[model samples]
Target: MKKIIFIICPFIGLYWLMSSCEDFLEVEAPNHIITSEVVFNNDETAIGALNGIYNQLYTSAFSSGWQDSVTALAGLSSDILEVIRSTNITLKEYDQNEINPNNTRNFNIWSSGYNIIYMTNSLLEGLANSNNVTDETRNRLEGEAKFIRAFTYFNLVNLYDDIPLLTSKDYRSNALAARNSSEEVYELIIRDLENSINLLGESYLDGERTRINNYTSMALLARVYLYRENWGYAESLSEKVIAQSGIYELLENLDEVFLANSKEAIWQISPAGRGTITSHTNEGSIFIINPIFASLSHFKLSTGFVNSFQEEDKRFQDWIRFHSGLSVYYPYKYKIRNSTESITEYSMVLRLAEQYLIRAEARVMQDNLIGAIDDIDKIRSRAGLELLAETNPGISKEALRETIMEERKRELFTEWGHRWMDLKRTGRAAELLGANNSLWQDTDILYPIPEEERMKNPNLTQNAGY
Candidate 1:
């Protein structure tokens, strides 16, 4: 029960990336001094090691990096955010949907993702050898590490389709790792999430929602199942989370949903750097362009997305803000424009509203039209709109599925790459993006593997039409 002292050893992190294959996943060598005995002998050091992983998550190198993180790449690659036509080729590539194999943004995302996975493996390896930490502490730490590894891989596989699946800290295996099919990667993701659910406790490790708990694992697994079209599992998991009424509830006020302590948030990330409510590192600050700082914003909400929301929709009215005398509208969900006295909001990763949407989609596929409509209405009711039946009665199965997609667009826009990934998974990316984006093609759904990676690893094959 020693007081956890956070430690940073840069060389240990560097060791994981130093492989002869030049493959970003390579992490075969380490020159650091701390051994398993010192690093994981007690709960404090073990948890501190895990906190280091979360620190990596906060830094610009990972979640906060505008060029590489999903907050930007996924936003631009999809239709939600329109990038300013500027000289930044990386941003332009995603905006134009004409990315090349060598696009640095692709490289950044690939490398950063594996760096996190490698760190998680390191944590798992240390935890396995620890005898000083109590059994309860060990189980929780293992669960959190597994959850993080699974979440990182989920993002990688969704974007790259076929990717190297690395679970151990062995650099040789990592260097020689070949791309696994999407199916294989998904199986690993499911297995890890299931393991985490069994090991993690129901309560949050801390009062803040930044830490992953059993519900967080369940929420993510439900999303993975929905993506895989495992309707029964997805529906049941979504229902389990939804039943936690004492712990979670939909916010009546639209503006309150993104607050740091919002009842809606299942898991959130504390802002990096300045460590204030309005830290520039917060994704909210990046999305909200303050006039005092810049004359031109990085990006703005698309006209189509803006117009898609009904005039009466509460989200459109409250969550989106229009610049004076300009047609451009930016996401106003994260209200603090700059660093403030206290932190007011955390970057939201998973929430209760999405669970409702997940259940709705699962119900649609099972031909439970009434049940599906019921779930959709829960979201609509909170949005200050009438129920689905009141507006569009007796909707057919095909039409109801489409309705759920539209609901997702209005509810989840600009949050993550939800819109972009939604389109790809539903077989609608080509049809929807082709008509709107001149550069979009049917094959543009999967980004090409970084060219440098292919050159170093002869075993790695480039994605089609790179």
Candidate 2:
């Protein structure tokens, strides 16, 4: 894999040049290969610049939903997944919680995250300086850019504990920047999401769910608030998203939940962004173990994770598949392993089911046991399981909280780092993982800042365990 540059001048425009060599998109800006003046001069180029960010996301290591992405790496770090190949030492490090700061995958996650941040910062800067761009276009672009930045930082802070928060395109300052406290990062995340909500409209731009909208920001913000322990705000924000009944709903068929533009998706990344004729998502191609390519499969669900789900659970029946030849269970949420046809599935980022879980957890924190049960029941009902309201109506707060956490693990296994982050946020990681694995340590909660990053910036500090 290429070592992605952290600060590339005119990142988005360069992407535009690579994807579609439109001569009009070229601009004569010295020092910077592309400039805000030309890129944001009008709506067409400005939108293209934004699209560049979306397109690049499909290839970015941290967000790509591929083998090296957070979905795989973090899933390995948790108990939900195990690396199938012992020869793959890097992935095994993550699975065993013995990751080294010098690990290339760690570096890729760090660099790729900052690469996207640089694109967002550049977009925001370009929109701020352009006067010719329509107010509508400027506002929407700014909101989306900020949301992306916030989203990136949110993941960075959670993964590495303290990360440099770069909100501008100035490479000099960014190169020497020190890490910001997680609290400071969360403050910016909250502010950016708030601004995104105000600037973005309710409808998905151009009818594509891949584009950020007000509800998308709300869904992410709801998660942020839940992590920050702002229970009331988290509850209200998730409720706002869940209340959009016409636009979003829990799909009765578990198979339809991951399809492109599904009503359940709050935000999705289209594989079309990859600029390739191959339309299947990286998640599908890497995770599904086709018999002919079974030897190439790098990951499989852990035995404990597979056993955690009841035999009758619809999620187990629909979202997971067993390979009789290899005797392994793999994530089947994404059905297409390889395809040349038009895209059918997308890499899901934020979805409606998570909002219900967020709301349910938030309500549990606020002493709204009944309301929390109601929200949890929404997910259970869709899963073809007996509703909590009917099965255990008088459950206590402590037990209900545990139940919600279990539900989250069952419902959101391989999507993102939800299981890993959930264990950390709830302070259950050490207790749970330590009992099962002798190698588990309290300091393993946060991944180390990449050694390459520390070398680049002498001012940067390493996390304690590293």
Candidate 3:
């Protein structure tokens, strides 16, 4: 086996120094490249390697929640967001679902996701070969690395149906790797999450919710099962996470949900990970329209989407903001646009609200109508809407399922491409988006595998209708 060489950079280790987390900051200066042998020789450096992955997530184009991130790109691909500037050809492709194989932004989303996967693979190999680290440290690092890998693969598979599943850091082999079936990719995702759950402890390491824990793995795994339509496991896993009310809960005030370390967050990526003076999350910086710079803003909530919300829905009132100057409503889930103060909001990846919706859908699929309504009402109640149980206790299973889908759209919009992925997974992308988008095609559900990637590797093939 070949040793993985890591180019340790300032941003990778700067996360600890900036956050003042002493335990993971004792490594050497972050300027020089170091081999895996030295990185995994001690506890702190090995941990720093894992920390680097988390930090890079804030910088990675795919997960950063910025204009290039999934939240913005996929929101445009879906109906939730509209491109404020039609001149941006890259974004227009996503908005119209006519993305060219040569589009660089589409390639960026694809390559950036694989970059994180590479880091995770590197960390996993280093941890496996090292005997200098303690068992406790090794297990925790392994679990976190696997969880991140699984998370990245999940997004990639959804975006490009059959993707190159690179599990190891063998560049020679990986450079020429062919795309694997979605089933093959998902098999690895499920296996990784299950192993991660067993390897990790119940509590967040060092009391930081940003760190992956047993429940974090379970939360993601539950979602994976739900997407695969494994209803029993999805319901059971989500039920377990929801039961941990002491650690996680739905905040009564919707405004507090995205705050750093909020009880609502199951897992989050801190803006501190960017290692920049501008502490505001990318989501806020891109989506929130500043009057002075209103002309520069790129995206706004779609008019149809804004109208989809009921008049009394608190999410509509609390999470959406209107700009009279621009005459458009924008997503305000993350409030601070330009701030140099201490970090206040961490980008929400998984939360308690999604679990409730997941369980509701799973239950309805299992024909537990009454139980399903109870779960849906939890989200509806938080939004200050009439409880479904009271308003439509006798609703049929089909109607209840549609209600859950609508609720997910309203609740999870503009967050991690949930709306786009939901439409694809539920087989409704063509039916829903086609009605409005003239460019809609069933093949558009999967982005064209980047043309540049195919050029580099002859084995890599393009998706149909590209």
Give the lDDT of residue 331 in candidate 3. Answer: 95
RMSD of 2: 4.2
List ranges where model 3 is wrong by over 4 Å.
Answer: 1-6, 9-33
Poorest 10 consecutive residues by lDDT, candidate 3: 16-25
TM-score against native, each model = 0.92, 0.94, 0.94
Cα RMSDs, all models: 4.3, 4.2, 5.4
Residues 221-323 of candidate 2: C-alpha lDDT, one tens digit per residue: 9999999999999999999999999899999999999999999999999998887899999999888996696877899999999999888789999999998
lDDT of 2: 0.87
Candidate 3, residue 296: how far the Cα is off, in Å = 1.3
Between prediction 1 and prediction 2, the one with superior lDDT is 2
Question: Candidate 3: how many backbone clashes?
Answer: 0
Tens-place lDDT per residue, model 3, 256-311, is: 99999999999999998887788998898899997697988899889999999999
CA lDDT of each prediction against the hidden true structure: 0.80, 0.87, 0.87
Candidate 1 structure quality by residue, lDDT tens digits, 1-466: 1121224443222122322224433332445547877788677777777777775676533365354687678888787888754677777888878888988778777767877787788788988887888899899988998999999899889888999888886756776678999899999999999999999988876687888899999999999999999999999999999999988899999899888868999988877433344554356666787677444567788888898988899999998998764457888888876775567787788999999999999999999999999999999999988898788779999999998999998898777688889999999888888997776778899988988778767778888878
Q: How many collisions per candidate?
A: 3, 0, 0
Q: Which residue pairs in model 1 clash with each other?
A: 16-27, 28-171, 277-343
